[model samples]
Target: MKRRTLLRATGGAVLGGSVGLAGCLDQFSDSESGDTDSHDFPADYETETFDGQTVPFAPLEDVAEWWENDEARFVDARTQVQYDEAHIEGAVFSPSPDGLESADPVAEWDTDTRIVTYCVCPIAQAGQRAATLLDNGYTDVYGLADGFNPWRENGYPVESNDGQASLSTYEIEGETDPADAGEYALAVHPETGQREASRIDADGGYELSLHFVDVPDSSLLELRTPSYELEGTIEEFSSATVQV
Candidate 1:
């Protein structure tokens, strides 16, 4: 949807005071500063509203500079399986859009911190969480524009937060691992340590996927190919066989 809301600053001299308001996100406490000055902040704040939440959304190219900064925190809004399969560097799994809005994960963060939320989609569930922060009085909130795809495409680091997921390769609640034998078949990625959930076999080629479900609803999946990582919503075991 085309956003019509104008993210203007009223309580301050200007909406955005400076280019480096990012520092304010890192160092200033939400209580330390009220919504008094929009100066030193991203100028004329504008955000794309998703799911009734207005998050600071910016293009991948625009916020690329933030990747190297230490003050930024990237939150993965996708499911645990997806996160275990792939995710951006320094990202934490909050699953805010999935109904964890008032959860402790967000509580761990100070209201004054600058958090960049993301998800798997053309748009993101993080938009809602970003808006939540703003509504709670957070001055700085941003949603990574292209979501996780841009980060991976840009060659940034990705990892599986498998530890945070409820399921693991060691124990398949339902479907059996069709990739390898024994423990290796149903095990975490040796390198990423993410649990392997599903595999793909197509025309003599095969791939694997680790679906993350605990993530916020603002995310989607980017299967690597004939292989996939499908998120299972039910407790019963589900299975699918693809012919190679």
Candidate 2:
């Protein structure tokens, strides 16, 4: 199946020099923010909340300029199959959870290099990866605010394979022991380490949307948290009354 094509059609906020727990760049407007005639890269872009963190956001326009001038490296934070289907022209696939570990290309880049992370679900996975990078000392990182769809839709540069299956969202929802509240629930693809994570809420509930290309109901996944790990097939996850 091709991607579901459910795109978010909303404008996003701009970027700042530093990231905080939560805040937004004032929504850009010529009338409100005075003259809007600056081309400064990060300032020109917007901000958005993704994956429970405030990350810098770059819209397509700023990203296009960065692409042409070689100002930033792009990272695809989706699954390998999603990357193989279609991605920005030169994005490297380094799906979250293990994005920059071991042999990932981004690991070799200088800590100060400008990096941008993106995923089709707007910015959740991308923001998670970008947040990881920033926490580990990357100087400049941003999540693609509108994600890959806008770039592809507007006919920007991309690399793609023919006849590949598009992505679909696989959801896993459950409640854990109340003691586990404030921890995380992660769904990990056993093979690729592609993952989705959500914080266990105060009531011990969590839900995750794992995006993949051509996932079978019998495919293995690891549902994990700090205290326990449960392994099961996608079909099993759908029915399991997991309480740990």
Candidate 3:
């Protein structure tokens, strides 16, 4: 969706750059920052809670097919780095469960269609994504279990959103080291501008499991990047899988 498609969308280049460049740039936010929406979720994991709450996950295939023809909403639940690597087609980059009501917040929705959400893999984060939609009165809310991995695993279409906020990825880095696996988890969504992730997995593992959730989950939500080595467990859950 390029602004150039609109006749009045662009004027001529101004002294600085162009008349269309200054006031119209922010007119492009399309996530769910402050509205109501809904969709369907995959079926897999169960709902659990410790710090906040971790919901079960849904199958990726079932979810993709569900919205393949339907005009359902889509969201990415991973950090910016992970999302930049790859994401489902036509999905916005709002890590928040609700998409709207977020720091960066999605700014648009059809409302009539259902809204679906996902994260690196979709289990607890999907629940978090649903919470936002439900709270905003969106009845048709859901998560895409097995997130991007499943989509790519089956040779489904995926894209890279370098900087489209609405369809951009997040960056889940930590200022400090993370606890053992299964003990606690933290994540960040760069697309939505929600610096702190609340909804997480609390019962997937135990302290013996490195004070984190499952090994995969821990790795996904622990660090923001590999080269920098941000502070966190960086578990590699099926939901939030990273290529590198």
Candidate 4:
């Protein structure tokens, strides 16, 4: 499915308060702080308390180190659209606005899981998400100090739906052909019981191109038609470039 269509179908779900892009970018403006060239940590950046616990800010440099060592789980706190466009490799999507009100993707993670939440809005949105995670018993939650833009500017690794790691095509074949299978859904399950659906073209020959990030290696991909269902492992499909 195209990234845009998927985002639209999801109602542009944002994890935090629905701040406009201009407002988010304003965090970097010279008028806001009189220093435009420096990515220095803001002195006024204060600690926020949630459930009587303070959420600490994780420096971009430290987070980058953790990312390289694969020691911390990165959570994107922006809207799904922003996440789809670009995010740190392996970061999970957990929008703040919805995260506080409902069970998010990370809800089932171990309480000791190391997590860092980030957004272009920098503080308000990301901080709220970190606080929420902390309140939920995630002990090592931290907000990315200074947010995504600075990290991107520093040439750190980023992944996007448009990138090579995210683009893959597969052919679906089964007793019930998708062209005639009305209103079917195609989903990828990265973990057991967790399914993220992809957009399907009913008119096409059941050929689906998906972002690889949505279907990590070893994940399960399932196609559900009205009368039949077909499932395959991502490795199996990648092996042959087609599945039956």
Candidate 4 lDDT, 180-208, residue by residue in tens = 32222343442532222212234423333
Q: Sort by lDDT, best first: what order?
A: 2, 4, 1, 3
TM-score of 4: 0.47
Report the error of model 4 at residue 12, Å: 26
| TM-score against native, each model | 0.47, 0.61, 0.47, 0.47
As for lDDT, the candidate ahead, 2 or 4, is 2
Residue lDDT tens for model 1, 1-244: 3111222212222201110001111111111123323213455544554333445565566556676767667776654556565677777776644325456476677867777777643332455456556676766668776566667777877766455554221122222223311111121232322232222111222223233344322222211111222332212122333221
Q: Rate the local accuracy (lDDT) of all candidates.
A: 0.43, 0.63, 0.40, 0.52
- Candidate 3 residues lying further than 4 Å off, grouped into runs, are 1-57, 97-107, 162-183, 187-244
Task: Return the lDDT, model 2, position 76.
Answer: 88
Best by lDDT: 2
- Can you write out model 2's per-residue Cα lDDT over 1-244, one digit (the tens) per residue? 2111212212221112111111212211111122122113456466544333446778778888999999999998877767887889989988763474468989888988889888753245676677677667777788777667778889989997646676566767777665555455666676754565555556767666566667776778777655566777776776655554
- Look at candidate 2 and give me any clashing residue pairs: 13-46, 13-47, 14-45, 14-46, 14-47
Give a tens-digit lDDT track for model 3, residues 1-67.
1111111212221111000000111111111233221233334333332123223334556677766
Q: Considering only N, C-alpha and C atoms within 3 Å, which residue pairs clash in candidate 4?
A: 15-95, 15-96, 15-97, 16-96, 16-97, 166-212
Winner by TM-score between candidate 2 and candidate 1: 2
